[model samples]
Target: MSTIQQNIELAIERWRSESVSQHTLSDSSAYFRLAESLPLTDLDAATTLAEIFQHELTFIPTSRNSGDWFIWNGIIHAKDEKNLVDDYLATEFANALKKTADYATKYLADSTMSDEDKAAGRKGMADLYKYARSIRSAGGLNSLKTRIRYEFQQAPDFFDHDQRWAVMSDGRVIDLENVDEEPLAPCPERPVSRHLGVSQSGQWPAPASLPTRWAQALSDWTPDKEVQDYLRIAAGAALLGHGDAKNIVTLVGLSHTGKSTYINVLREVFGTYAGELPPTAIVQKYGGATNFEQHKARGKRFLYLSEPQKQRTDDAFLKALSGGGDTITTSKKGQDGVEWQAQCVLHIAANHIPEFDTSDDAIVGRMNIVGFDHVFSPESMQRNKNLVQELIEHEGSGIMFWILDGAREYLKLGHIPVPTSIRKRSQENVVESSAALMWLKEMVDSGELVIDPDAYMKDMITPKDGYAMFSRWCFDNGEQLPTQKKWLKDIEAFNHMPAERKGKRSDGHARVWGVRQSAHRESRKLHLVQDGGSTDFRDLLTQLETVPTVQ
Candidate 1:
């Protein structure tokens, strides 16, 4: 009855006419053009148009569509036939429009939402637009697979055409190209025969002397129960092909606190079966390569880079560490006056966190930081010495082989979920850990592992006092409080501090300082003794206490 309603009806009629007349116009482009012509007198009109467009786009993929032509035909038919607008689609669009209108009206009336929230909302909408475009272009499940395979084949340096592909129940094709040759377990719906690997060669050659060496190493050394537990899990993760398990285990502690000793023991364990190379060997072997070549070389189960210091942390290292399921390349000079490239699995262990320049939360969120908060007492040192001797003497034993075998079997099963305690520790300070957790949950759902959902939630959701300490540290360092956008900056500044300054001091003897950027100038101003200090540093503490809190 209203002018706006009449205009909408008229617009719909015009769209139907245009669609039937010329079958060439893209649904999205046509919608945009129609929206431009609409008399959007209020926020409701704009919201209504957005909702309708979104619904129309979403339904196009779900319909019986083949290639691009089928999609175009469906769009044309839907636009032309007034009766084609189902009740369900119409209701859904109306609900979406109402929600948007409500939000706009509330914001106009109260102005309570911050500019930052508004910006985030806008960005989310933009991302949604891109997602809609991708879904539309793909058309259907089979089309999606064809597109994916085509993309994979076109990948630069992708040498292995003999890769196997498995179609998931959700219609996604998991390409096993350049991945380990081990056959994956089949899902319930899929036939077990579908889970076979490309290399039909029953089993790859096991490291000939691995069993003997592992037994000897285990016999010679005595590891603490907790450390041994971690090692077993790591080894199992490696053998089972859980890439994260074999990559790197950061042993954090003060100097001479057995961090290096632990690594040496692990090396000895690995050395029994295969020749363990130093960090330099790994760096040189796969540092320069095309993305596809790098992916192929990454077939190896494990890599170890030791003591990656502040200076050693760079974009290349960060990319290699964080971006799983992606290939990376570094250019190098070849003997034949041509460029060369190498690729391998990136496993790195650093004494300190990486110092990155950007504020991209996604980058840092990919890392798993395991803290070694235990202190090294005199008793612990004596125990370490005894273990060292034991490992040296017992170079080969069945008990050690059995242990390695168990670990390997556990990893291969890939069904056992990571213990709650371990997952919690790794997930701390990492946002993308949510995705990792989801992957773990999927494993549980697939009956690969048993999980106590409540326990897992408690481990991940409940914040501890340590989060407070981290928050205070960020505040004292003149960084923004806990936020996804400022995570990298906080990490960079934290990593730059001296070892003593990394942890909190009850005595107030430790001091943390940094430079704070000023709006008017290019240079930053230095802020020293930024937190409350001990009586020994009373004057500095008093001055620091005077500074305003960031409320």
Candidate 2:
């Protein structure tokens, strides 16, 4: 009968006919306006609007903060830092509450209201304040925070495409029209973010020009098709979040050689799923607070470090990133630390090989090195100046297909295929980075050192300890000798067996490793001896065998 009652009924009638599910609460501003007109005693009307808020949003309280609010669109999404959804809801709620409080005061002075109405108004105002306090303190939007609490979920096997979900490498896109379907059903946890920029059409025969152009860009890096194929699969692994590949890809090349261009394209397409490598990720800092640097990569699928100059790579951090099994602990400034298994594949590009603190197999085995040998001529550079943007704009869909195809291939193979170029370069990076490896490799190449495998069975200790020999070699070459412990580890990593240490200091058996001077070098020395005729290596061995030991 009253205008306020008529307006509230009209709003409800429109809600039933149009379906409140069809639009978010923010889109239906008329309902909030009706709440603004309702009498203060109309607790039922306020309750209805509050119930709509519960259906539209879910709040998750964090340990030390008010927490995050997620709203449902096609899929539930967290309130983005840049978005105003939460702000809009807060403003509307405040306005409606303010209007009702004003009504509670205005009705007190009104001559039109019956005596029963004034007494009910006073009670309603007290009840409204109590309700508002409950909402402001512990209850949020009809207790939505408690009733509908949910954790943000991740679907590693699926990536967000446009506004829908598509199975990675499968090309089957989920129809979000009915989200209550098996995988998309509204549950206690749900994926609330989109990472991929392009969607798979599931159609065959991608645009030929895309691959052709991509091949051209890659050809500038390497002429080897296997290397190109490996790079393609690496991209696929990145897109599919397959850190299980357990290898970090290093793109080594000169400027204008297309390495950064390639990385930039991936970063652009990966969007939120790709993270920039923080300084602490590669270089370890001393005496600093708990570095939250790794936290930036929490949900990322790919991380890129570009042109890091003259810094020793953090072996432990990098190993943990690609190792797949290690759980990394990261924290915010005041919040509690969170632990997660890193699923991100790292790609580091630099003009030269990156130095490392150590050169063990853990370092060698986890690296995938790709060299971009060609520096594009000024003319070629001029032509492909905007190569990355061009490829992304014109061939985005095809590129997505290419990457997904690589994911499918990687899944089928169960591992990334190492190309000859990649293997060679990766080994070179490890060897060149360690002084012990360099000295050992040089000695081997010059016929000055050889592995004595027979000594392993005989438990023979060389007259000279291998580490001592390496120390002397380092002094001769003006290189610093690594610690003895590291020397052993490096040699073992170089494919030589662990050194055989026999008996205590009381016994004559010295702690010697399994390396000795090769007969080639010894014979060469014999050739230079004037008093002694050039003795063959076989004769020298016999003479040494006949010699008496100090023991």
Candidate 3:
């Protein structure tokens, strides 16, 4: 016999032999499994698998039970290891479970599917499992996960992103995908993606009451009004399902400044919606050279990098995340790299801010730095031993409202406005934060201006020419080379005038540069200076070096 035929016959024999116990195997499961065993075309293999097997089996119908269930019996001359053949009688009850699951998933995913169809799908899943039909599924995504996991033994990795479907703070599923019915089962592996917290359930917690104790404790402990405002913005962005305004929000301070505590509060507030808080940054793996965790942040909405000691950030990865770049390459375990848009935001809180020396515009644009200088007394913290738990459990709906309201205001504000202190702190954090800005600031301080972008220009050089000179300047200074794009963007960032002006220079009627170097004594000093006025810059760097390093 042919290999395909042999395979089909063998599968049938195994089925018949196993069902000697009188198993009423459903046609779908039998057909699906037996037909799948063929190595060749399903057409011929299925015919042999089904027809030959059915012809060999015997059915003895019972008069007592409903016709919905069939009491079919079969026997097989199966042998044991000792080659002792016997007439084996076997039995199992198989129904249209696979068909029911297929129907249920199809209806659940079909946005335009009718309510009746949807209800049938729900009923199928509910009948199969208790959680689907329970009240616990009404709030968040955890129950949804539980049901899917229970049915399929694996996690889901896709959902419908087109419809902007989300589990709201109240836990009622809202899908741009779903119209009439409430939100239903979310599979985060096909169209888009989804995730739920470990401790969260599908049921929205009891009417989201306020966490007055937590709030009061926080206010009493860290009395910085700016910190309070920032907390609101951070929480709001997380709840509203939007990226942070600053793209990357960093909370920098000594330990006990509530960095971890605040993050825990956010976790409590967001519950199942909160994402994994990684101890190290993705780029910081392998001593900040390789990205071993590119897949870690793919489906997460809120990514927390807590106490990341290393300064190395994956510029391309972070840029894509910060809205600085459009796309990022992601890698799954043993999979090829795939590109995805930045639908997620990041929060990197550390005792010491990270530094970057890269020249990518996408990298430089992701600088939202906040410093918490206050160090709460250890004695005060000791008294509130269970404060974190109390806030998470008791704060109820009050924290929800606070965060949602903050989200509303955040939408109106366009982007989170960087406080001056944060901006300065950002400058201190990175070695190559903005070389152009640093140079400009240095020149201003030294009263030795070289190329004042703010000044109107008679020298209008081409962008290409300007990059050549800038490249040389950066190379000689042993600094990160400025790309043409970053050079232009830096000028724009500082609001310099005559950004791309056309003007005549010493070579009469000849275009030079938009922001030209002045024809003066100080301008000549730029050519003479070797260290770019290192004396003053050294002092500046010294002050910035106050942040201690920890391994």
Candidate 4:
């Protein structure tokens, strides 16, 4: 094979791995470029392609520009943008042809036809579909009169311009398809096919006025300006046809805090585009490989969980998903777990933020915690019962506009910076996450869990005892052992003391590494006083303030 041809094959192999079952000629598309390098003219390109690739070749000459672009199977091997607008258009055109094939099959199956008529129709009018559209003059499906507007005609802002917009964690628009859409499958004739919000259908018609009233209502509803913007941005992000966002947004608030109403508005605005990943019931509470598989298999752009704590969500799924990107072994029930790109933008609402060993920065880094202190009692919600529906259905498009604008901004900045209040609360949650760590730090400070410096002088403490103490601390805190290695490193870094030493377990079986108090903690404290440092989180070990351990 020629070098370029070999390059084509390599690219197709990669596409095959990533394409899942989308085995359309378009899906394995590096092969499309094969025609581009050929010395033949544009007219000859199609002939050469047909000659080279025999795998179910079907071609369509577009109405707009006949000479330039033709659909070879589902692949639009266009020379330039003058021909191909976007992937959506290419896919839809292929669907229209696929539908025609089904229609032909039905017509050919008609039993009432006379024998001569049937044979003649087979060779004539029906078979005319073969070359009827291919002729240069009579533009097949592309006939301006016969053309379908299709969804690609909508969103001139997105398609006309190269810029992409998506939603952020707070549900606003920023900028940024699943692998799983069958290439040859018939897609419905709808404008907004890819990312339809739960209560949406067709393209969102921009109202005479953008939904400023919803913003006003939200302003009236929320005391914090940042949170209101956060909500708006998150909503816009959901409108994002695609997203690169990796953070999970959770609204933790008191009862009747408008969370339900707010989320209901999102449900109405987002429509079937959202759902819980792994589904709430399909996931086991404690967690298993299958639950992780379900998560990996999740194909939604927006996965909504309205108070999942009520369902007793699985902790393993929560932990794994929070720090996603693991090429997890996932499969359909009885099948072996196949690797899939884990990409679900989670939007969660709950009364309490479910802590998932959040002390470690790895897990903490992925969290976007929004504190919802505002409460609208049931009577208050009852008084304004229809407000949510109006905001969602009527004023919703305007709000969608608001989100779209935010999405545009997000594309530029790359990320929406979480408000400081949310960050502070998250930090507090982390420190307060572990009662055992809190107790261990307290006991160490108070000389109760003292590590003798002289014992270290003898060089005798095992890592196992050190981990045991760390584990025990987690038991006391009601948290998992987040990062034993990090904890040891922090102890040595913070106190300037030896946190670990060569020692033996209490059991007479073997000598193991033990969690010895760092020798440096005392020096770091001394250094704190020597310098102008006021001991305001001077050491990571001492960052957590004392929590009452009455239990």
Question: What does candidate 1's lDDT look like per residue over 274-318, in tens digits?
Answer: 123233322322364333222222323333556543333334433
Each prediction's TM-score versus the true structure = 0.33, 0.69, 0.54, 0.48
**Pairing residues by index, what is the TM-score of model 1?**
0.33
Where model 4 places Cα greater than 4 Å from the true spot, the runs are 1-193, 197-212, 241-243, 278-289, 292-297, 309-323, 326-339, 357-361, 378-383, 435-486, 489-551
How close to the true structure is residue 527 of candidate 4, measured as C-alpha lDDT? Answer: 64
Instruction: Specify the highest-lDDT model's number.
Output: 2
lDDT of 3 by residue, 264-355 (tens): 76666555445664544345455534464665665455667776544555656666666543656655444455555544557777787655
Better of 1 and 4 by TM-score: 4
lDDT of 3: 0.47
Q: What lDDT tens digits, residue by residue, belong to model 4 across residues 448-469?
A: 3454444543233344444555
Count: clashes, candidate 4 = 54
10 residues in a row with least lDDT, candidate 2? 151-160
- lDDT-wise, the better of 3 and 4 is 3
The whole-model lDDT of each prediction reads: 0.35, 0.58, 0.47, 0.45
